[model samples]
Target chain A: MAQFMDVHHGMKGITADQLREAHQADLAIEKDEGVHFEKAWADPESGTVYCLSEAPSAEAVQRIHERAGHRADEVVPVPLTV
Target chain B: MAQFMDVHHGMKGITADQLREAHQADLAIEKDEGVHFEKAWADPESGTVYCLSEAPSAEAVQRIHERAGHRADEVVPVPLTV
Candidate 1:
């Protein structure tokens, strides 16, 4: 399993709960795409959300986000420590 | 090496070159701490710098940053995708 962290920007100045709901909604899509969300965080000040997930590919990650109605600012692969 | 991303904020509205220099300095510290830097990025508008690195522990990551004379806003573990 490859780890990925997706950084999202321009959340439309949404509230924390609202953002959480969007993320939870996105999580559902991720599950459908065979991705597992290990953890997630949102910065209310910056309206940015960071999500850590395990997925086969970055494309799969983007698909999940697209299906959930949010576009990522950047999606980077996380290499495991040796 | 486990890949971790460090998100930094409040860069005092520094320029990209300045931030990059700071990051390069930080990378030297990481190398000394047995960490390998994969990639790093900075957003001038938000004054955010994100770094990808491989390290055994988050504490080690923090130490590298401190040694470089910068503070991290957040450091989240990236779970490998399964």
Candidate 2:
């Protein structure tokens, strides 16, 4: 399994509730894509959100986010974590 | 308390040992700046690294990284997490 970090841009000023709901959207159907979204962090001031997940591929991670109503602007493989 | 995500660029082929060593370097003296580096992720293919930390300010995070020898290219406050 590969770990992925996906970034959502232009979501500035997102509230805590909105962030949770967006994350929940991904979790709702991640299983179909073999993705597990572990956590999401957002900087409301910058309007950016970052999500960390374990998935078969970066595409799988993107797919889950897209289906959840937001598409990730960037998805990078984080093969090394410490 | 705030969560920050910092990015490091131009280290595209960093090895696992190198990554761990770099992280350890930051951990070795993080307390001096009141920063706690929770984890780090690297994408050797893209030569990008992302760090997650709880810090008093983004500057403190950057200071620790700079002192550790790998200055972050970008640092953003991720005050919201889920």
Candidate 3:
């Protein structure tokens, strides 16, 4: 499985509770796409959120996010990790 | 200390060798700013790079990247992570 790091913008004023809820939303249906959301980080101040996941492709990551109601602004393949 | 996720854009066609070298450059001088780069991921096609680190502030991460020669385009404080 390939790991991905996706960025979400325009989520300004999102609280910690909201972040968690959104994360859960993705997790709930991630398995349907053979995706596993491993970790998420948020900067509420900048309305920027980052999610790390293992999936078949970047599209899979996007689908999960979009279905969760917060489409990611950018989804990049992280082929190299260190 | 806080964790940060920074992105670097516009480095298209970066090879594995180049990415490794760049990561080494940051690791070499990261201590000067009391920063530790935990990991880095890159997508040569998108010319986008994401770096995860533990630092006192986003500025510290930026300083290390700038001194190492590839300044990050965006640095967001990851106050909440899960």
- Best candidate, lDDT-wise? 2
Instruction: Give the winner by DockQ.
Output: 2
The regions of model 2 sitting more than 4 angstroms off are none
Q: Write the per-residue lDDT of candidate 1 for residues A6-62, one digit (tens) a residue.
A: 888775455656766776777777777788766665545456677777898878888
lDDT by residue (tens digit), candidate 3, B22-81: 999999999999999998888888898998999999999999999999999988888988
Better of 1 and 3 by lDDT: 3
Clashing pairs in 2: A11-A47, A12-A47, B12-B47
The order of the candidates by DockQ, greatest first, is 2, 3, 1
Candidate 3 lDDT tens digits, A1-82: 9988888888788888999999999999999999999999998888899999999999999999999999998888888877
CAPRI level of candidate 3: medium
Q: For candidate 2, lDDT tens digit of each residue in B1-82?
A: 7899999989989999999999999999999999999999999999999999999999999999999999999999998999
**Which lDDT tens digits does candidate 2 get at residues A10-81?**
997899999999989989999999899999999999998999999999999988898898999999999999
The TM-scores of all predictions, comma-separated, are 0.53, 0.97, 0.95
Model 1 chain A worst lDDT window (10 residues): A73-82
Top-TM-score candidate index: 2
